[model samples]
Target chain A: DAGITQSPRHKVTETGTPVTLRCHQTENHRYMYWYRQDPGHGLRLIHYSYGVKDTDKGEVSDGYSVSRSKTEDFLLTLESATSSQTSVYFCAIRGLGEAFFGQGTRLTVV
Target chain B: QQPVQSPQAVILREGEDAVINCSSSKALYSVHWYRQKHGEAPVFLMILLKGGEQKGHEKISASFNEKKQQSSLYLTASQLSYSGTYFCGTEVQGNTPLVFGKGTRLSVIA
Candidate 1:
């Protein structure tokens, strides 16, 4: 129900190709996060941004990069797609006490 | 680190009760609960801060134990709508991103 949106809700890319997923929010939240969900792995943090141009790596930041040039937009990019990187990616923005998530983007790399 | 959730999966009849527990090895600043259907974004359920508080939403309730670095979620008189995967996320401090547990899949049968 939050004002969060993810672009390219579903995507399929060939291996070694670069892919980027976009997360946009209208809540003006200061904290934005990118997470990936696999079948057995509930959710793993990929990267997060606290403010414009301020970003940090998470537990599974390998092969991924993030940029937050504006407060409402956060981008997650896979330098080179791989089958192992196929997963559902979610974007979340921290609100009063809880975080609001987007509809999620399902990406497939073959 | 990710929290450890008990009972990887659960099955309950309509109007029955069930409980899901989440434990962490590191200290917790807060515990967050979320639920996701088969293929959708996770929906925020509740958040328990460091004060070791208990909160409820409808028939769903959760308790946080700061001392034990754990949290528990209780679903009373469960309904079919409750059939989903429940995840517990732990935050080490304010403004910090969460580390989520391997979710518990709940199936409610009529």
Candidate 2:
């Protein structure tokens, strides 16, 4: 209910192909984060943006990239998809004292 | 580093109580709790900031111990709706992305 949405709720891409997932928010929050959830890894941060054009890498930044050109949009791209990259990706906005997440994008690499 | 969660899975009967613990090796500035049902995105439960801080939502509550760099979530009189994977995320400072634990799967049966 934080006005966050992730495009392409589900996707299947070929290995070595490029894929980009979009996260759009209407709350105008300054902090936006991208996380991937796997069976045993839970949610691992992929990348995050603090403001427009300001982004930083997380622990699991390999094979992935992110950009935020506007306050309302954050994008995560997989340069070359791999089977290991298959997971549920969630976009979150930190507001007030809590974090709200988007519905999540389930991506599978074949 | 990712936080460690105890009791990878738990099974509780309706009206029973449960506690899930999350510990981190590094110091923590805050701890956040979230729950995700099967095939759904996680939803924020509550956040605990300061040492000894405790917060509650309905029958679910959590405590943060800064000295130990850990947090614990408690659920009293659990319901079937409480069946989900519980995750605890740790933040080292403000505006930083959270690092989540592996998650504790909880199942409540009638």
Candidate 3:
């Protein structure tokens, strides 16, 4: 309940297609993160933003990109979708003492 | 670095007790606990900062040992609601994105 929401709750895109997921937060948090959750790989970080126009790659930042132009919005884009990229993506905002996640986006590449 | 979680999965009867441990190779500044039900986003449970802090959430509690770079979550008298995949996230420093463990699946039966 940290006022975070992920757009496109579910998406099915073809391989090689470009897909972008959006995360919007109303809490005005400085730290925002993107993570993908798979069966055995739990939550793997993809990208994160510390402030407007300031972002960093995460452990699993291959084939994916992120941009944050405003404090309330963070976007994750898959340049070319692949079957391996089919998973649930979560967006989180780090608050003073804890982090809160968005509902999540389920993307499937066919 | 991603933290390693012990007991990949666990099953328990209602009212039973269980503990999940998370260890990180890198030094940690904070440990965060979260639970995710199937097809849902993870919900924050608690966070323990540096200084070897211990915190509780109802019957669920966690202890963080900064010296060993490890954290343990304890669930006492588990209920059916406790059934979910538990993930422990570690941060090397304040305001940094968290790296999560593979997760510990817990199932509580009646």
Candidate 4:
């Protein structure tokens, strides 16, 4: 893991409940991304923020939302958790070269 | 679109060599390689820009071919630490988020 941190390293939630995962970075990088990793799917981008208060949807943004109030924090929210959303979520900060990832948050929706 | 990775799984003996390939249907501006161990986050390996150049990361090296929209990761003298899932992420262009392949799981046995 790089300078990025994801809170709630592990969580078990119920379907239909709301959940939010937080990613904090000390790198002060301009690009922050939220991704979910599942078996056979590798990692799929959920959303990304280029700068503070600037966010955009990713390839698999449906059923997910993101907010970037500050350059150091990016939050991913699942309005209503679904079983399909259970996976390991990772946050990455892109530097001039490669993207550094957080330890990851494993969320289980039961 | 997500890139396609070949040989979804591989078994290699320590000190052996392995190659993982990633190909994209769309034009590629850059390619990023990352490795994720079981229960860990993905760590950056290397990045190759559109120049289709080859870059090295320790015993691992990568080559990108922009014209073919593909990238290959080469592991020389594989070590036990190299046993992990390798993912290739592609950026269609600058300022765009990456789309990852399904990943290639490498098992380096002693």
Candidate 5:
């Protein structure tokens, strides 16, 4: 198994609230990615970080933001949560050959 | 862009074999494979780089075709432990986040 962990394994927030999910890794990998998995859409990228303080937006970046202040930590935030944002969020770390994912956080915005 | 996977669902008996295919319209530099059990994290499977490379872990194997912009995952002599959802992720440019397909659900029964 990979040395990656995700905080708030499960969460429930009301609409218009703020929520933050954290991903921590002990492998010191250079690339980190945040993705959301829904019923029909599968998994879509939200944001990714290649290095400390260096991040990029993915296809579904709207309504989501990320920060990587350190190599081992990557954070995803929903500034103002909405029902549409309710989904399972996953974090992945990449290496030379393949990438490993965290356990995932199940978020439901009611 | 997201990759498209074939056979939304599949059922197999122990000691059987299965194949999952992924196709993308965007130019692909690499292809990755992952498997996620129900309500669990997706474990890293393999990555096929450009120039028709192949790589895998365990009993799984994969191949990439840069010209066709496609990839296929082959599972030989599948076991009941192989029951899960298979996902194919494509890395377009180097350092770019991987875009995943909808995924194929495979159930290996006894």
Candidate 6:
């Protein structure tokens, strides 16, 4: 696993509230990505960071933002929570061979 | 854009075989495969690079058709441990992150 952890393993929030999920990795890999997993919908990337301060949007980036100020940490923020925004968030670090994922954060918007 | 995966779900008996396919709308630099067990984080299975000249992890294998903009995963002699959701993610423009497909769930029964 190489020391990958996601904070607040599970969270329940109300609609319209701002939320931030954190991903930390001990690995010095250069690539970090954030994705959401929902039933019937596989893992869809929301955003990714190639390097410090170098970020890009993925297939589903709306209503979400990301920041990677350090090599080992990436943060994903939801501007305002909505029912449709509820899903399991996973963070991954990529290496030459394969990618490793964090445990995941389960968020529910009610 | 997210690559689309075929056969949203599948079922197999122990010792049987299964094939999951992933296709992209545009030329892909690489295609990645991963499997996630229920309530667990996704673990990388393999990635096929541009030129369709890559294969990864003997236990789980995949092939990429650069010209066809597609990739397929092969599971031979399936095991009970292989029961999970399999996803295919594609990277465009080379040296970038990925956009994943909806996923294909495989259940191996005894």
Candidate 3 TM-score restricted to chain A: 0.98
lDDT of 4 at B45: 90
Q: Score the docking of each candidate (DockQ).
A: 0.89, 0.89, 0.91, 0.88, 0.83, 0.77
Better of 2 and 5 by lDDT: 2
Instruction: Tell me the TM-score that candidate 1 gets on chain A alone.
Output: 0.98
The residue pairs that clash in candidate 3, if any, are none
Could you list the CA RMSD of all candidates, in the order they appear? 0.8, 0.9, 0.9, 1.1, 1.3, 1.6
List clashing residue pairs in candidate 4: none
The 0-to-1 C-alpha lDDT of every candidate, in the order given, reads 0.95, 0.94, 0.94, 0.93, 0.91, 0.89
Model 5: clashing residue pairs? none
User: What CAPRI class is candidate 3?
Assistant: high
lDDT of 1 by residue, A1-110 (tens): 67999999999999999999999999999999999999889899999998999999999999999999999999999999999998999999996589888999999999
> Model 5 segments beyond 4 Å from truth?
none
- Listed per model, the TM-scores of chain A against the true chain A are 0.98, 0.98, 0.98, 0.97, 0.98, 0.97
Interface RMSD of each: 0.9, 0.9, 0.7, 0.8, 1.0, 1.3
Where does candidate 5 chain A have its weakest 10-residue lDDT segment?
A: A94-103
How many clashing pairs does model 2 include? Answer: 0
* Pairwise lDDT winner, candidates 4 and 5: 4
* Sort by DockQ, top down from the best: 3, 2, 1, 4, 5, 6
Residues B3-110, candidate 4: write the lDDT tens digits: 999989999999999999999999988999999999988888999998879999899999999899989999999999999999999998886898999999999999
lDDT per residue as tens, model 4, A1-110: 46889998999999999999999999889999999999989899999999999999988998999999999999999999999999999999986768889999999999
